[model samples]
Target chain A: MQRIRLLKDRIARKLMLSLTIFSGLIVFIMAFGLYQRSRPILAIKPLNELLFSTSWQPSSGKFGFFPFIMGTLWVTGVAIFIAVPLCLFTTIYLSEYSGARLCKWTNPLIDLLAGIPSVVYGMCGVLVIVPLIKDHIAPFFGTFSSGYSVLAGGVILAVMIFPIIIHVSSEVFRSVPAELREASLALGATKWQTVKHVVIRKAMPGVIAAIVLGLSRAFGETMAVLMVAGNVAKVPSSVLDPAYPLPALIANNYGEMLSVPLYDSALLLASLVLLMVVLSFNIISRIILIRVERNIR
Target chain B: MDRRYAEEKIFRSLTFASTVVIFLTLAFILATVIAKGISYMNLAMITQTPKGGYYLGKEGGVLNAILGSLYLAGGATFLAILVSLPVVLYINIYSKKESKIAAFTRFSFDVLWGVPSIVYGAFGFTIMLFFGLRTSLLGGIITVSLLILPIMSRAIDEVVRMVPTELLDASYALGATKLETALKIVTRQALPGIMTAVLVAFGRGIGDAASVIFTAGFTDSIPYSLFRPAATLPLAIFFQLGTPLPEVQGRAYASALILTSIILIISVVSRALTGRFTRHVVK
Candidate 1:
């Protein structure tokens, strides 16, 4: 019986090992396949030109990534700018001010938004925002500038990233151990003060991670931007000016291309750029999260 | 004493205002979309096609587009589970304990999740082109599976992490071995979480407009097979708006709302599931 049990254990161990390797290999294969596909433009010299150069004309065979990169950055920055303050304060209200019933309602309400289709967001942008801009705002700005502009895209994206930021920030605030809050109050700090000094301070890293996650999401978002953004493939002079994002560019143009290696390469290059922007944000958040984890530990 | 009393009033009001802003922002968007979509919709307008250029008048029953969207998204999401479950179980529960090899393997998925969906679409596109599956349902399924994998994997990972370590120890103590324990005990306990993950993944894939556009192409026809191109709701909305016909434009809004409501419902249900699972696990 003992011998049979030992044999069974060894077989299970071997099977588990094989399964793990197989699963992990699929992830590796998928990632490497992407890397291989992008290698042509992702190579040093061409990528440098794409990144630093300021020109973009596909017909002219000139593709400078600066405009798209800047567009993505500005839009992402705007989204973060709009989302963070709103999320932080809302987290405060929910964690500190709200009754249990309100807390229950708000938490699920926020998470519900996280699941909304990006296409719906686009619909709102089109039916609501476009008219609001075209009929109301664009008149003040100029006639040539249509409703489709960075302001429309960035603002719409702000609404899109709002739920994610709120949900994550709320979760962090909720996790800040009730004992800590009680300790601060016992020390004579008031409700708002305790939240500001003790609760927010302790949860700052996690809050920052949430914001960064929201920013990365804004940067890499493809579909909503595709529809809302005017797809001019240029850097915007202002939020009211039109621009293109890397994800939008990739999604819009990649399918239409014939087997031109350079076109395919450019699309891959676009992916890598979007990947790097998102990865850097992720890496930054991961570092903060790691530090936060260590501090909590 | 006067200063302290005044400060209290101001601070309380500030928090109150902030709460209102968050609450209103969400409420405004939801109410506005529902209002706009419903206003544009009428039965005949839905059942008929457009006359003027796109965006001019609402027209046509989005019957074909709606059906196509459901079929493709549903099929792709189903196929994703077929491949991802075993993969997730292997990575999460079946990995060797305390092994450096296991850590490296885990890192691979971390990197995979970080890769953009467009990269997956492009890679899938490359393969599809090679196989002559351009603009077909098969291509859409592969692209969507890749897109959903990271999210599905992450959700499954969360569930695996939630499975109490003590349960595993107990299972092993019963002489069930690692595989049997994971299959019977850990996964069983984590079923709700796993299901929620799959539901969310399905919603995400179904809601995706960009990934399926190239892979599935825009087809009003419901696909008879994997070889046929199928237009999901998001793609249909995109194509309809792109057209010059007024009726097609109206069809876009109706389709958009349908897709949005379906995804919203799925998300709400999954959110409830996750909340319940967490509460149960905590207890």
Candidate 2:
């Protein structure tokens, strides 16, 4: 009986180990599959041309992803610019100045914002932000904007990513040693000075991780951006100009790829690019977060 | 002295303003969705599937989507839990605290968690092609299970890691096997956390749209089998919002409201249940 029980234990341990390894294997398989499917496109089109060409007419065999890449960068850049200050300030307030009552209310509210689906954000953008931009912000700039521009995508993304930045940064700030704040204050520094000079500086690495995570989310965001980012396949001349980002390109065209030869491969290539970019960002942020935790010890 | 005080006042006000803005944004989103959706929300919307000409701005409800979302997310979350429990157990119970295999697996899960849902969709599409499988509920569930496996496992791992080492030591000292201690002691201690992880994964899987768009081709009727195509609330909202007709667009808002409510309920219920479970926890 004792020997039988020992054998059962060994089998269970091995089974669990294999299951854990299987989880990692799935990611490898995904990357391999994407690479295999995209090889045909990679063979026909030089890497530089496929990545740098401005024209994207798939029917004409012109599959430059440059415009979509630029669109993604511009939109994500704008979102980061808009979201960072707001998130930073909110985190500071919550961590340094807010009373327990306020923190109690705001934390759940932020979680609620995080839980809301991206599709709902897209719907809200379509109904509210899009028209608000078209009628107000666009007209002020003297540009004939349809509201479905890069700016609209950025604005919605900013909202979508705000919770992540705030949640992570607040945790970072909260972890700063109380002694650091007291020491700053003991040196005749004001509360704001303590937060700005000591707490924020100590929390910088975690804050950067938060921002990187937010940026990754913005770059890969699909349904919300697709709804607002007027899907024209051109590099936008300005924020008000319509543009197509890579995820939108894949989602919009993947279903109909059979009509045009090599289109499927091109779309697969786009997915590969997105996967690589997102995976790198995730790794960089994870390294930073790990360092932050190590330093806390 | 006055100069320093004035600077502090200005900066404090700015932070306060930003905090208020975050709250206001949340309020505005909820208000808009509720105002637009309340009119069209009815029992029929939750009870009946889409009828003929439904996409054409005609009659019928989003019952198919409601049921399909529940089915797909429920199925995926169940599979994820089955896979995740063993992985978490292996990491915390079988391996050393800083084992390389455990560290590498955790890192891979972090990367997988960050990969966008659309990439998963594309990857699922590729797998389907390789196997000559068409879009179906089964494909969606499998792909979604992959998407949430990392999330669920990571959450459970964190909780399991927090279990007091003394407790495990005691179990081992009593001549219990590693598997028995893991199953009997650690799991009971981490039950609440495990429940929360499952709910979070369920919420994520149900709300996700990009991951399912290709693998779970849309339908207007309830999918009777895993092999059949299924409609989901997120996709329902997406398709409805794409229509040029005003009524169909209204349906989009209604669908969004339903999805939002379900997520909100899940988060709240999980929080409450987690709190209750904490009371019974060893820690």
Candidate 3:
């Protein structure tokens, strides 16, 4: 008791401690609720069946998760594919060639684009982007009559995530201590050579991290993807196919499911996937942060 | 020299051309939305709930939707602050040795921030259905709170750690009570920073469509009961756009513009608040 008094007050510490537990109680409770719901409700009997089964029929009490999971991965994967390369090239060009005056105007425009709400993107897609794709790009595929294809959704998601990847990678590139650029330039290297050889390599990990973060955001994105992706719960053969990702399925189905166990389980199962992805994203970004900070003088 | 200049000219043009293509599309989108939506931004729109087939010309205004946005976002933001601020306070004050549980709490918070809003919506809807509050404002509020809790707590946690240890020691040496010290001294200093988190949470709450999708399903009429389904601007847009009707379609664009403008306003305010607070804190 004397030692406690000699130290700072421990009694008050106990109250704050309770506060900490209460804050985390919901995440704990929700996670527990999800696990409890996972077994019987989802009918996820064998790991292979859960992973491989194609049909997801709630009417017949057959709940196979393969298609929806594949859809999410495919859409997000396509988004990343379209986004990462363009943003990388854009970042490199901006870092190496663009003037400060131009960058001053350019960078914040991207931020504004980034912060524009997702629903607006969905609306724009609904009105403008979808039609443009339908009229122009989807004809290239020549398979779909109307263009609510995975390709169109991925294209929009790519545009949506572009700012994130560009912003993060450009920040990383800008941090590479201009001395490196100057040194490469001094060695008679062209500006393009200096950037490609020096800046891109140095910032690669951060760029990867940024792309992964963008991937995570795209994976969990609901409103924009839901509005545009032509929510047919099927597997996509190409980027030009219509589909439903896991988030869309949950949003579309939760209302009409008359207390069905499969309904609850499918939603929970989707959430578990979302949870794994977002956690992986944070950890990857943190690793990049660790490495970036470690390398800094 | 002439060849190099020509090459550089081509590179610069390409760079400018690509940048313009991307940003010009964005500008065109914003301009169209604003120009189309501004006509509907009447006082009635700010205050009243219209019945079926609401038109700016006919049904008076979007008063109910605006107010519902405020009510839902305001309640959710308040609830999140209530849970988050105290937890961050505990994290700030707990002596390193005594705070293993606090450490664990923070570990979960990191995970929570990344969880998709739809998942929260799903989890929340599950519970609300169990409790007989399906598709209600209460459900919406709880879901948004859960969504923002981790984000605000993390922001608040970082801000609290900036309060100097010297201040803490001095307050303790003077025999100020722990509550007094944390509340009066540390929190007062951290107020601007904490307010940034609150503002951020509010902006996030307003912007979210995902968290409230299942929890706050759309209704044509304004909800008189917390348990009744309510329409927000985002949900309204989703419904209007999703419908097969053309009239509902035009309204979706106008409504989407309205919804997006609200989120933009919120984002600008939060960013400005954080900037102002950062300046204040640095002083």
**Maximum-DockQ candidate:** 2
For model 3, what is the alpha-carbon lDDT of residue A227?
A: 82
lDDT of 3 by residue, A1-297 (tens): 556653555655675677677776776677666666565654446647765788888777767778877888888998898777667767767777776787887776786787676787877776676787788877776755366767667877888887878887888887899999899989986776676688878877887778877888888888888888888878888777787887887777766665765666756776766766676786678567557857865
| Model-by-model DockQ, in order | 0.43, 0.80, 0.43
Q: Which segments of model 1 are wrong by more than 4 Å?
A: A1-31, A40-45, A140-144, A259-261, B1-12, B39-60, B96-115, B130-132, B271-283
Q: Relative to the true interface, what fraction of contacts does candidate 1 keep?
A: 0.47
True contacts kept of each: 0.47, 0.76, 0.45
Candidate 1 - CAPRI tier?
acceptable
DockQ of candidate 2 relative to the true structure = 0.80
Candidate 2, residue B135: how far the Cα is off, in Å: 0.5
Off by over 4 Å in 3: A1-12, A21-28, A42-44, A93-111, A140-144, A259-261, B1-22, B39-47, B52-61, B93-108, B129-132, B161-181, B274-282
TM-score of 1: 0.87
Candidate with the greatest lDDT versus the true structure: 2
Prediction-by-prediction clash tally: 7, 0, 5
Per-residue lDDT of candidate 3, residues B224-271 (tens digit)? 778777777777667667767665566666676767777677656765
Top of the candidates by TM-score: 2
Which tens-of-lDDT digit does each residue in B49-146 have in candidate 2?
88889888778899999999999999999999889999889988899999988998898998898899999999999998898889999899988998
- Higher-scoring candidate on TM-score, 1 or 2: 2
